[model samples]
Target: MAIGDAQVDAADLETVAQQLGRTPRGTRAIASRCPSGHPNVVQTNPRLPDGTPFPTMFYLTCPKLNSLVSTLEGSGLMKEQTERLAEDPELAAAYQRAHESYLAERDAIESLGTQVTAGGMPSRVKCLHVHVAHALAKGPGVNPFGDEALALLREQALWPAGDCSAS
Candidate 1:
């Protein structure tokens, strides 16, 4: 699959389901893939087939990555980052831009008529998973916190060394 490709095939869906350990609802595309060509991030619809509004547009699917992010989250990274947002004006501005960009992208797909973007953007760091997924899907230099989280993982040698698709 190529970047920004909206097509979601059956095999990819199956792989995503296996990664998630459940059926993925409102997934519109495989947003990003791991080195082994497995869906690591997914672009989801603003609304589900059942007409339920879903705010998260990009979702992380690789179990290894998910677990790694969870570990980071468990380390109180989100709370620390949220505190930094208040003291760091530049980072706060960049995060606001990220939030706006996320809203625009999701609104383009289908508006949920709300300002809510995922991961508590614009003011706080809520979920590193959403940030990492956004960073992977859109590439580097978009989400500051996401880039920071990935850097932290790399610096700590916590990043997965093998194919993360195999779980």
Candidate 2:
């Protein structure tokens, strides 16, 4: 489907969740956050203080929470296919291809790494959530991932806190 045509459905999420052994609550939560409200992706700015404005912002409507809903929602494909792969080689191979897409996206965003603050922002980009937030709040120059960006970053170690100029 075209990116615009893509959507996150509660039932689809449930099916995907069931395949991965996640609780219904988890699936629903994921659905709630990404709820197809926004259209475009977000990004961060080049100059953010205290990481305020997240150094990024997206034009799309905001998701429901501070968490990385996009990543969770995107993972649906992998979760849905994992079980099928275990039982069917063809399905598994297909799932692998889908998973490769997900991983490539995840890796590409992770590579952006919260913009590094040009010598580290006064606040620092600790935690993937914060980084993503910063990226989204600031928009563009600072962080490329935006809200979706932080969701990916959250899986890694937090950004160290300190002054960039001093270091």
The prediction achieving the highest lDDT against the true structure is 1
TM-score of 1: 0.94
lDDT value, candidate 2, whole model = 0.33
| Per-model lDDT | 0.89, 0.33
lDDT of 2 by residue, 58-118 (tens): 2222332332344543655233333444566654454344334333433443333443332
Best by TM-score: 1
lDDT of 1 by residue, 37-153 (tens): 888999998998888998999999999889999999999999999999999899999999999999999999889999999999988998999999999999898999999888988
Q: C-alpha displacement of 163 in model 1, angstroms? A: 1.2
How does candidate 1 score on lDDT? Answer: 0.89
- Residue pairs with colliding backbones in model 1 are none
Worst 10 residues of 1 by lDDT: 1-10
Candidate 2 TM-score, true structure as reference: 0.22
Tell me the lDDT of model 1 at 104: 99
